[model samples]
Target: MSPRSGPPLDGAIDVHAHYVTPRLRAAMVDAGHAEPDGMPAIPDWSPESALADMDSLGVATALLSVSSPGVHFGSDADARRLARDVNTEGAEIAAARPDRFGLLASLPLPDVTGALAEVEHAFDALGADGITLHTHYDGKHLGHPEHEPLLSALDERAAVVVLHPTSPPCWEAVSAGLPRPLLEFPFETTRAVASLVLSGALERHPRIRFVVPHAGAALPVLADRIAAFSLISGGPPIDVAGALRGLHYDLAGFALPRQLPALLALADPDRLLYGSDLPFTPAPVARGLAEALAADATLTAEQQRSMRRGAAEALFPRFARPGPPGAAEPRPDDRSLRGDQR
Candidate 1:
């Protein structure tokens, strides 16, 4: 762990906040899908309003990425165009307020070539902090051979890739009127992590730092089961627990007594980072969750502090409060860090 950059660095660094630009919102509305992926009505968001909420809630910075039902809404050409537009705008937002914003450039995945090209531009030209990827593109999850080249490229650069759960193509519909995110989102996250572990993608692409969303979804509860099956099957000697431990996790959704304890058992507690999942979870819910965490007896002040800012500061120190706070200046290598948080 890196040294703590104290005091003014006390504010939380939200790695999971989503940005819904006017154009992106309009595109969703035009798709004949007002409730994309069953997320109620799309919540409103703007950088100014987000910053106000951040200030009110003690958030120092909120790294932005497109939320559920990512930009690749069935047309490769449109996906590519939307990706470029979204990323360019996001990068500009981060550049405009480097201290309070960070960009995780959206890539047009399921189209490897376009994703690769965008990755190059995001880092080289836009100076984006990292890339965000969905658990599965089309029907292929992250571990599928189709994504190996892209993962390999990210590994070569030691990029921080954040994985958000998108409803998999094969998911069955539940009849209870429950939203997809109510259960499917977390399951999809587990499915992707399981895919990565079973197929050895996590092991092969060792340098790529993955950030798992929703407190690693169902990963903690399923850890032992995944391990026993993989090891006993006599496959490619998988270390499921080790793989889970190596990846980072965010406190999105509700990281309380249940999720937090399970997460700590699986990985270093220091790996925990703060996430608001704002706009989708909305500011009010986000605020309530934050207050709950602060009052949770299961976590210590030290532990909570780490979740808020300390751990994230170490993970992506480039965003550490700069100038007057006595926090260290971001080193040359700091730009390489990226993480997934929703």
Candidate 2:
């Protein structure tokens, strides 16, 4: 881990945020019938809007990733094309700003060939920072053998994989009566993590960096239960806690006072990154983060600093440059660094 950069460096890097374009909206509309309720209206997501938010909120830089239903809506060909468009638009934003923006390429899973091909295009050609994958494909859990090749490639390259949640197999119950994102999202994330852990996906792809949203989607609360269930059922004891130690968790939609301490106990504080899940519900996660960081003064100044900024530098590394607070300009080596990591 890098040394803490201290208090003056209030530079925040949100690793779990979303970015969409008109092309993405048109793609979504073209593929799907209607926009679901509670999802934010498609704002004009430009470099200007992101920069303006960074300026207002004291966020220095944000690592941009496509949100769920990411370019994987239609046929493999259509999905691949949409993924390219989304990545190209993101690259354009980074090209113009080079400060406030970076991109995580949205992968078209279930289409393994397309995924591997896009990995090359996005990382080698467009210079995306990382890859964003939904927790599951359609309704299949990530534990399936089909995902191994993709995970293997990512592991070989040491790529950053940001996992977002999608609706589960039981869609009617989740989509109809329950809140689409509020309830189902976290549930799906938890299910995916459990499936991955049980199927030894984490063991196979240890080098791939992961940033799980919604404070790791209730993982902290259910860690013990998972372990107990696995053990009681004569399942292999694979040290789930140790595995999670290497995973990075983001503080998005996590406001409970009790949750932070539990997270601190299980995962390295340096592995926690700030996330706002912007242009979506639960606006301005910083206020909640401030409360959590301020909740425990017993934590050393260095620990607090890591929670605020240092952890992000370690995970993303592109935000380590000198800049004013809330600066939105991309670093000079942004593209190269992203490629190097990939």
Candidate 3:
């Protein structure tokens, strides 16, 4: 394929981006969770700032999701309310600029009914492109039976579910009290995926198109080991390799030459996507990561292009297309899903 006007992936879609809503950030600070999950402070974010970053980074569209320590904070009612607020605000952003933005609506997970309600409101009312979920809710991993109802609903709809990681209850304490994002988050993602595979969630929810973040977490590097563990543990006769092949993976944090090879071993061109993890990872760092990915000798020009552009285009076709008739300037208040927003 020929190159686009700007960078290598001129119109690439960044699927693993995080959005720090004003309300959520304020709440965190108020609750003395200014360092939520042990991060120094919550990152400041605005739609305008994100759009600018996307332009400079050569990203066409960013599928925004609430990052770690998600919407929930103890009370189920509080979780439901915050989730709705976040999803509504996010929908407003995407509605304002459908071409440049896509909503991966956050759910109040571990509360199946609340999650189901948000799913309906997100897809049916807000016109969200997909839903984002943490690897665990409270302390329950994705594979837990409690999550099956939500998973089943997503499966029935053939939903595009983006699985992000959160440090679960078991990991409250860490070495040197290092930030959860530094080391635990990646492994948490791996732990959740393993739970899904071994618990037969992948097999049962075959149609739920899961987009795994952090280069399939530690899965690519540890897929075989996990499979062996499963066999030795006498888990449900699972097709460990085949199960992994079905999910999509985004290259964000760990796309080094050594890491890319393992991902390539597990997935083909179409299953790869570009992710910035912006704000959390500053634009300069994102640029460096992109540069490194481009310089990786192990990946071919075609495969790199696929990870950068082709795969994302196939996933979000509207962004890949030229601006539709009468595209308007994006505003924080604008809420036009297709024609109008209620």
Best by lDDT: 1
- Against the true structure, candidate 2 reaches a TM-score of 0.85
* Per-candidate RMSD, Å: 6.2, 5.6, 4.6
Model 1 segments beyond 4 Å from truth?
1-9, 322-342
Cα lDDT of model 2 by residue, 46-122, tens digit: 66667666554446778888776677775998888888888888887776655567888888777889999989898
lDDT of every predicted structure (CA atoms): 0.81, 0.72, 0.80
- Which residue pairs collide, candidate 2? 98-329, 98-330, 99-328, 99-329, 99-330, 100-328, 100-329
Model 3 residue runs over 4 Å out of place are 1-8, 322-342
lDDT of 2: 0.72
Q: State every prediction's TM-score relative to the real structure.
A: 0.89, 0.85, 0.90
Native-to-model Cα distance after best TM-score fit, residue 82 in candidate 2, in Å: 0.2
Q: How many residue pairs clash in each candidate?
A: 1, 7, 0
Q: For candidate 1, write residues 1-342 as lDDT tens digits.
A: 332212223477889989988778888888755786766798888998888777656677888999878888788889889988999899888876777789888998899999999999888888888899998998888999999999999999899888898766755544245678888889899989999999999899999888999898898899999999997777868878889999999988887869988888898977888888887887777777777776687767677777777777766778656543223343332234333221
* Candidate 3 structure quality by residue, lDDT tens digits, 112-173: 89999999999999888888989888788999999989999999888888988887676656
Q: Rank order by TM-score, top first?
A: 3, 1, 2
- How many pairs of residues collide in model 3? 0
